[model samples]
Target: MEIGLNHYLVLSTLLFAIGLIGVMRRKNLLLLFFATEILLNSVNIAFAAISHYYGDLTGQLFVFFVIAIAASEVAVGLGLLIVWHKRHGNIDLDHMSTMRG
Candidate 1:
């Protein structure tokens, strides 16, 4: 009747799986970024759960760093998405190759 590490792990695994599927199936650049964020959040959950289970702060610390990085990634990624959308008038992944150098 109580939550445990296994519960967190299962949830994390499910989230990661969903994110992976989204990344694979989504053709929009914004959707891909969303999937990546989901994947990052799943990892954060696992790290925090394991850290709590082991009575250690390292996992929690790592989670903080991950959050910071994820935030910055969202900023840069959204900026790029906006630029791409402006230039192309669309955000399809299939047409991204047109930006190649």
Candidate 2:
């Protein structure tokens, strides 16, 4: 079977939708972070497909930058998660409220 741009787009759409649902429904910050990663991966798939179709390197270059950013985001986000866990002893996002302050 020959995969085309449309196929790639459809797959990415499904992935994004699943990620959105997870992000909206999950109470755990770790799960929410995983969903965000899925969303980023979907974007990368679309960009790579477009770059391949256009025979241009720009999209691939953008993908590389995106990967770098995602790596940094995950690292920083995990660090924050650790700190929050240390203070709160939990990672449930719903358990947080500034009114507690």
Q: Cα RMSD (Å) per model?
A: 1.3, 1.3
Please write out the lDDT profile of model 1 over residues 1-101, one tens digit for every residue: 99999999999999999999999999998889999999999999999999999999999999999999999999998998888788879999888776572
Which candidate has the top score in lDDT?
Answer: 1
Scored by TM-score, the top model is 2
Q: What is the TM-score of candidate 1?
A: 0.92
Local accuracy of candidate 2 as per-residue lDDT tens digits, 2-86: 9899998999999999999999999999999999999999999999999998899998999999999999999999999999899
The lDDT per prediction is: 0.94, 0.92
- TM-score of every prediction relative to native: 0.92, 0.93
lDDT, model 2, position 57:
92
Candidate 1 weakest lDDT stretch, 10 residues: 92-101
